[model samples]
Target: VRLRHALEVRSPTFDTQQFYDLAEKYGCAIVYAEDDEAPEWPKIDLETADFRYARLMSSKPDEPTGMTSAELDAIAKQTQAWAKRGDVFAYFIAGAKVRNPAAAQALIAKLA
Candidate 1:
């Protein structure tokens, strides 16, 4: 299961290391979420878990593929690295929902 805003809210007082340890103990992967509004959200590294989960929430309506080429390239690189470690699950969950499909296709091509 992925923790969204809850993680952000609790980060101030919560023991981050303990949280990660618990997740690892339970065979759960904390999500790495990217959002323009919540740029300060903690970025969990791929090495922290056996599997990876990422949410790409910065897709823009003005961009043809929901994201800029540079953004796609960066995501592709990160995903590739995560794939080397284990399974990777990424989703374009917010912003310009209509362009999510295009963003996904673009990312796939970059990964290819």
Candidate 2:
């Protein structure tokens, strides 16, 4: 079986070109995530891996779907842009437990 690995850099110190270089050298994909507790990417670029992976973690605690239309739109745009370059796997998991499915569907609709 082939080996596939992903790196989720949670600290700003690791969000550097050198980190990406190491990831690329090891054929590891960098995980792009949106979370209140995690450091976001300094820049959204797709030069580190052949594929893309993202964890959509930015959602207000009170928002039913955890995300608003504007947020979904922004994510859609980014996902589309990344898709043009290669495959993108995004998960909407950082929101209300009951709303994640609906949020994901809404985001899918936006992407569609």
Candidate 3:
């Protein structure tokens, strides 16, 4: 089955190198770094999102799971902070929506 909760990284070019391996299994990817112009990501929106537990996709729990609650919270806070600081578009473009509608909307709201 095609998974909807996609993976997104904070610094696509920089952080991607660290998490791309972890993210490759997902349906999509996004990257928003500190200095990038527009974040690179495929098209996705709330209507297309579906949240799935990271453990379901993991063969090993010790490995990095992109959808962990902590990760989501951190990314949300960062996106929120960026938005409040007036870099809203940067946060949305940088964030990829693989399946988490709530988180995706949070990021998108910041963009708006």
Q: Which pairs clash inside model 2?
A: none
The residue-by-residue lDDT of candidate 3 on 3-111, one tens digit each, is 3444443333434334444554443343333312233522222111223111111112232332445555665565555444332332222233343344455434444
User: How should the candidates be ordered by lDDT, best one leading?
Assistant: 1, 2, 3
Q: Clash number for every model?
A: 0, 0, 6
lDDT of 2 by residue, 1-112 (tens): 6666767766678877788788999878888877765545543454477778888777666776678898889889988898887778888776456677877888888877
Better-scoring candidate (lDDT), 2 or 3: 2
- Evaluation by TM-score, superior candidate among 1 and 2: 2
- Candidate 2, number of clashes: 0
Q: List the residue pairs that clash in candidate 1.
A: none
**What are the lDDT scores of the predictions, listed in order?**
0.76, 0.76, 0.36
Worst 10 residues of 2 by lDDT: 38-47
**Model 2: lDDT to the true structure:** 0.76
- Candidate 3: give its CA RMSD in angstroms: 14.3
List candidate 1 segments past 4 Å from native. 1-15
lDDT for residue 60 in candidate 3, whole number 0-100 = 20
- Each candidate: RMSD: 4.0, 2.3, 14.3
Q: Which stretches of candidate 3 lie over 4 Å from their true place?
A: 1-66, 90-112
